[model samples]
Target: MNLAKNRNEIDPKFKWDIEKIYADTETWNKEFQEIKTLAPKLKEYEGKLNNAETLYEFLQLEEKVSRKLYLLLIYAFLKSDEDTTQNQYQALKSKIQAFAAEFGSYVSFMNPELLSLPEGTMEKFLEEKEELKLYKFMIEDLLRNKPHVLSQKEEALLASAEDIFGAPQNIYNIFSNADLKFPQITNEEGEKVDFTESSYFKYIISKNRDVRKEAFEALFGTYESFKNTIATSLTASTKKFAFMAKTKKFNSSIEYALSPLNIPVSVYDNLIETINNNLNLLHRYVDVKKKLLGVDELHMYDLYVPVIDVPDMHIEFQEGVDMVKEGIKPLGEEYLNIFQEGIDNRWIDVYENKGKRNGAYSWGSYDTMPYVLLNYNFKYNDVSTLAHEMGHSLHSYYSRKEQPFVYSNYTLFCAEVASTVNECLLINDRISKETDKKKKLYYINEQLEQIRGTVFRQTMFAEFERETHKLIDAGTPLTSEELNDIYYNLNKKYYGDKMVIDDLIKVEWARIPHFYRDFYVYQYSTGYSAAMSFTSAILRDGEEAVERYKGFLKSGGSDYSINILKKAGVDMTTTKPVQDTMDRFKELLDMLEAEL
Candidate 1:
């Protein structure tokens, strides 16, 4: 658990090869200027998209310029996240962000202009030039969103306001990652350690109750002190969603957020409804947690502590990678090859460092290898995170290989499916192979926690987002008090009477980064449910299911996320998948409780 205090102190091999995107910042700067020069050319084709030849040429040039722009943008983003405290990389990130906004404004006319073409004009263009066929799905999707497409002038105005719209999220990232500080806390070994956002997970899961309590209070206590400031940023972000949704003629911010992926509002509704019906299962889980911990009262800090301890189980990073590769063997050799390639090529940045961004994510452009960032702490959960993010990376790899740039990026709704599938497989593999009763119980507990954290916890978040957005849509200001009350109540309902919902946990919403991304967290719940279905199928049906699952990953954004998953045999449009997940949860709970 030795952490690097500076980025330079970390082993180079453990870092992602960002040089694959750009050899140096000077090269990034050169391409940045090139894109700036080429972006203005997009304006030349405005009001002329009705002609088939002109439309095809415009799309080609636009794609070429955009590919370069994203490459530069991704480079800057990776550089900035490496150390948020570095002003040079921060400036580099800012430059690309501003240019990207300008680029968005430049291409703003294309959608509106395409929509304004004569009825049957796009069909005629597609029939005339074979090249335009490549953009058929792109054009059709645009037509589907015709009601939401604003005028060229209006679209340009919104596009120009991209940076302004992004300010709240940007402010939150800087404030949390760079400016905010957590007080030092003593570990289980009586060593005073720097408590950080990344290390908070480590401390909260400490075997020592006092250590866990101290870290929990220290973390939330700091957030509580700045609750008003974080509340302002969150409120502003919600208002931004409301404004855009209203401007775009949507019924609500959730509709606006889901529309891009063509997700039905029912999908979001169904998740909340289904999970609400299953609250008893979560309450039972809380009861089990209380009993297993042998506590008179279970608090928020006690939730993450492992009730079944396997003290000797420490997974080094490479061992975790090996376990992941072994766990995913059901996917066959090709998937394993690609996973190993990512490892050999240094596509992952492993370990925490000073000023590093908290949590883990997989990101890359179509032209580059999918890269992952992690704050690896040698815990079993960190191992699962490695498997989860590599799941995303491999999905991106397959999608980019199989589809064109336009369709390479999958929707967020489908994004978590691949990641969660890997996690489910890895945990199940661990559980199946372990002979020791205590270790097996530990894995079972991990699986149960996964369900609780993913399906139950995230659905709670989705509900919170729904409640807050409704307030904004109704012209109600989201003050800190209102937000805190809403979150605290949801915790009580979800966790039930078995556990104590601490007042400090009320300020917890202020610390969630996903709150800034409107209507996004719900997918984690749906995705996990879908993954449970997929994992069950793959393990039960064997290669037939694996092929279908891989096909879904390769399909990417070419179809609606729901349809893609439907083709893969799990239909997210209904509540069956969610119900199936709950059934599995109950089975796991039954097993864990019997063992206890």
Candidate 2:
């Protein structure tokens, strides 16, 4: 019955400790000044990088400044996310962003200069300097984009343009997060409540039909009104990516986006093709939902609220943590110990307050403890989110502890795999233990929805991204009408014949912020598929699998994403992972059908 509370109203224990990164604002500002001062020093090593010993020292200094910059930026961003309306943190975040661009501009000469060195120069340098060997993988990653490095002046120009190119996402964030307003909707109790971005999901999942319909219309209706402006913003972002990619000599933006992570176009293509091949599974899930809800036709708004409601299902935050702990036990005690340390250390911002960010993420630098942001609503799904984010945190913890700072961060290609694997384990554990029939059905619904959203829906998103980029690549203008047609047709194809494809659903493409990110959503599909393999291995093979999985976590950017996943027992080059994931999906559907 309560709405969002003020930040002060939330318990300090539930809030993450930003002070852990910096003791106070003074300390943050001090580090901010230090990074600014360090920014100009990169020029000192501009021409000196060709010398093996000099390059080694320069790399060390670069790492030192990089670590400090990341910590400062993370603190400012996390603080701002806690209360986005706070102008103090907002200014600090902007200051950091500007500083980051300057820093990037200063360091831009390094790669181009290194590439300018004779081709075998790197190999000779690595052979000569022992310290340079530490950066072998790093140097290789840099040289891998040798074709795209451009001249020193050109690279600096591009680097300095970073802030200019970020205008669209920044504009979108401002509109969606701070400015956009939803109309108030009457709830199940006939009480008027203001709908918000954060509350939109909660309302959609409400047991009441009226609440879901009203909230859906109120949310997307606002988007519909602003569709023209939103369309322009998204189109600008798409063009920016296309321009950058073509400037760098890549064929398309998707290749530019995926190449750095060593992901091939075929992997992206295979994910789409495999998902399309299994569209029947998604359609089957939709049919099951329609039957369960007893609706003659399911509307787009009717998709979220579960068909089975468990009245006593309100799970406390602490209970969710405990559930995650037990669910991840198959990963062995050492893994759990590190996870427990993170849980005990206030590494999570556990509840939502006014102006807080809507979704969940695990974020931190190599220099800091892994931190998670969650807006816990005390539902069973929150527990799954907890488990998912903990997976990310643990991945960071292991990577940071094992690899050097340069190799600490993993790519989006492999990032979601760990999180989804944890979700699989958590849902599997809950489903196996539940005794009540309705509650079991509810859990099954939750699991199926996870697959529905992650595997099917995200692949659908992936295809949209691919198609839109291709359209731009082929010199076709992306008008709002064309974007809508593409999105609605795909929506219809994925959802199949059981549901009513509302006209308003066509406007949904204008609202997805990820479209601005350029080919980012496909990883959720691929990562989920890879995670299915790891989850099956962990459950069936036990300790050996856990150790291999641990190795994969620690590998980080030490190797390419595919190789890392391969070492972790998932061979993504073949369609086997996707097919195996579909098998798991059907197996769950069988269980849900038997339970019903």
Q: What is the C-alpha lDDT of each candidate?
A: 0.91, 0.88
List the candidate 2 regions with Cα displacement exceeding 4 Å: 1-39, 73-102, 156-203, 206-233, 314-318, 345-360, 374-377
Residue-by-residue lDDT tens digits, candidate 2, 480-594: 8888899999999999988899888888987788888888888888989999888989999999999899999999889999999898888898898898889888888899889
* Superposition error at 341 for model 1 (Å): 3.5
Candidate 1 accuracy as lDDT: 0.91
Output the lDDT of residue 122, model 2: 95
| Per-model TM values vs. the true structure | 0.85, 0.88
Question: What digit string (tens of lDDT, one per residue) describes model 1 on residues 456-484?
Answer: 99999999999999999999998899999
The top-ranked prediction according to lDDT is 1
Model 1 segments more than 4 A misplaced: 1-39, 72-102, 156-203, 206-240, 314-318, 344-360, 373-379, 474-485
Give RMSD (Å) of candidate 1 vs. truth.
4.1
